[model samples]
Target chain A: AQSVTQLDSHVSVSEGTPVLLRCNYSSSYSPSLFWYVQHPNKGLQLLLKYTSAATLVKGINGFEAEFKKSETSFHLTKPSAHMSDAAEYFCVVSVFNDYKLSFGAGTTVTVRA
Target chain B: GAGVSQSPRYKVAKRGQDVALRCDPISGHVSLFWYQQALGQGPEFLTYFQNEAQLDKSGLPSDRFFAERPEGSVSTLKIQRTQQEDSAVYLCASYWREDNNEQFFGPGTRLTVL
Candidate 1:
């Protein structure tokens, strides 16, 4: 079985400040991790994905995530926050060669001006 | 150039009524998926299709939910005798192929059952 846990339900950050959204995973096989962002009334957009490549992955909108197999964590981070970044973020996990993806509860990000 | 698209962006059905939601995946994509998302939660997988073949329906909540993709380009999810609990956003996603990890999502259809 594979699953993902998003640590924070909501996170607030001031503009230009760093942002961090934590996630942990449990999977029996080598896992593929991903971060997706959903704006209000919009579809989910893939921010980044890790497929056993480099431990550090960069994504769209200047976002990045580090895959730490030891910690069973893949936390998303951004050096600076912007107002447009406010949205719901989901942590997702799927095992290698598997099509089914397991999603986390999601974390709501609010960027302050 | 267009992404995954879904029709009937919003729908309302009375109890015991049947409803159908549609999805059109990206051109040439080989995999399509349906998911249900409740308020304030993440999307839950409902079913999966690979080129008109219904490969997985394990996530569907009940037998009342039926999905089909005849030509491999468009798919429909039909719900029978909808209940209030069925009210939620239904999302559709697609993968270019089995080897791809990224799945493009559609705007989703909001279903309200009264």
Candidate 2:
């Protein structure tokens, strides 16, 4: 019954500029959060995860996300966008004890020069 | 590759045809999952297996959809008399029990129903 809603369907950012992809969730219980990225013709890869240990979670490739309980958001951010960062990103939710995931619609990121 | 892998990376089936998709999880992974991804959308969970036991199949769309991991390593998702709505990318993921938080994904098998 839990789900994630991605605020932006597409995001465009210039190289070296900051990038933000928003996500919100609706869950009856406190849930673990994750961000996964899918590059062209490749499999989905884990970017980072928030498992209640930290509000701010750092991930691979200079990416990070913050879990805000008040806002019900776990928006992904990067200080400087790289050309390779252009890919489809998904916000995922998993409940305590149960590892099956619920995914957001996804946000397509495009990095320009 | 060290990552998960799915066979028949692309499959095209006529309506009412039966199709089977295969998934090879990373060696020693204890948990396996199946998901469906429609065009322009994120993948949706379909089923889960722990070792050789089928745990949760609540996400499966219909009874026509069937999945199995008899030996607990390789799994297959079979669709009987497929419909147009079944056209999507079938994704397979594997999770090592030690790393409970992350799931490694395979390059999904794109099933196209005509």
Candidate with top TM-score is 1
Q: Output the worst ten-in-a-row residue range by lDDT, candidate 1 chain A.
A: A96-105
Which residue pairs in candidate 1 have backbone atoms (N, alpha carbon, C) closer than 3 angstroms, thus clashing? none
What is the C-alpha lDDT profile of model 2 across B54-89, one tens digit per residue?
A: 999999999999999999899999999999999999
Each candidate structure's TM-score, on Cα atoms with residue i matched to residue i, is: 0.99, 0.97
Runs of candidate 2 with Cα error greater than 4 angstroms are none
Off by over 4 Å in 1: none
Residue range A1-113, candidate 1, lDDT tens digits: 99999999999999999999999999999999999999988999999999999999999999999999999999999999999999999999999889998999999999999
Q: What is every candidate's C-alpha DockQ against the true complex, given to 2 decimals? A: 0.86, 0.71
Tens-place lDDT digits, model 1, residues B1-114: 399999899999999999999999999999999999999999999999999999999999999999999999899999999999999999999998677778999999999998
lDDT at A22 for candidate 2? Answer: 100
Model 2 agreement with the true structure over A1-113: per-residue lDDT tens digits: 68999999999999999999999998889898999999977899999998889899999999999999999999999999999999999999988777778999999999999
Error of 1 at A92 (Å): 0.3
